[model samples]
Target: MNKRKYEMTSRADAAARTADRIIDAMLARFATTPYENVRIEDVAADAGVTGQTLIRRFGSKAALMNATVARELARVAAAREEAAQASPTDTIHELIHHYERYGALILKTYSEAPLVAGLPALAARGRAFHVDWCRRAFPLDPSLSPTEKAVRTAQIIAICDATTWRILRFDGELDEAQTEQALAALLLPLLV
Candidate 1:
């Protein structure tokens, strides 16, 4: 009986390890490859698992991508929550870092969201996440009217959004530090 239990435990551990490997492989692929271009066979080979195993594990390529995005969102959400405790400038710096880390995957997800079933929901969650972060990172005066608060919140969202990051980093050809400085300059004025 003890031997059987031990065998079951070992099998569970192995399964968990396999799942981790698959997730890691997917995230790595997402870093350098676009969502539409990533092949399941490549992910399976990278994870050291069979393509059939990946299908069995995730059901389909779309499921795999969805799972990958969910995992990344959770990670970013946690980081943002932690950064919320810091000063506003520090939070902006952290936000820029998160964008620099996940910008490519985010852009790909946004572009392919309509085709991917779960991606639109994920994108909505991302927008809410940014809004919540703005609320926490930049507290408004209680005396301000609701409409004014809403407008200011919208501005904060635009300032910290991924599109702004892309324009700064890609179009303006600014490094992360420059991007963070630019965001800080834009955000600090709104707090008044």
Candidate 2:
């Protein structure tokens, strides 16, 4: 690359590193305190950066919170992918298992953060990701038309969210094997 382009890229990378540090600090604070009320100063202090630095990188607390939520959702997506790898016939079950393992923390973090109140957009991204996964995992669910398939894909994604997992696991206390069987049964209508 040209010198100017290289310099610009370097600067962008530096900014991203700063933002990551600030967000990491914010996440640490969030783990212990309510997200809605955390001041910028606290995040800056936790991150060992100046308050102005936080503002410079994230613009506002709301924006920073959104970034953190997006980061977490990406992690969730990766975990889902890893889980799906082990159970090729039942991607939905794998995703639900992933939720049982990790979804609650993300839900709690996002729900408690006012800045992450725009979660519908995040959900849309998640829905799209699930649709993509469905296209890959079950390309021929014969019962579904194209439109129906898309809708079903979205529903499966929502069903794998934290609430459903908690309902099945915590409320019902379904053992791991039982939960897997239940999810497989529950998914039969869509998958078969």
- The 0-to-1 C-alpha lDDT of every candidate, in the order given, reads 0.87, 0.71
Off by over 4 Å in 1: 1-3
Determine which window of 10 residues in candidate 2 has minimal summed lDDT. 110-119
In candidate 1, what are the lDDT values of residues 91-170, reduced to their tens digit?
88898999998876777778877877787898888778878888888898888899999998889888888988999988
**TM-score top scorer:** 1
- Measured with C-alpha atoms, the lDDT of residue 121 in candidate 1 is 92
Measured with C-alpha atoms, the lDDT of residue 33 in candidate 1 is: 80
Clashes of each: 0, 0
TM-score of each: 0.92, 0.67
| Model 2: per-residue Cα lDDT over 1-192, one tens digit each | 999999999999987888888988877776667766789999998888999989988888878877876897788778666755654445766666676655566567646644465655775676577657655554447666889877776666555556666777778898767766666666656655
Candidate 2 regions with alpha-carbon error over 4 angstroms: 1-12, 78-97, 109-120, 131-140, 143-158, 174-178, 188-190
> Which pairs clash (backbone N, Cα, C closer than 3 Å) in model 1?
none
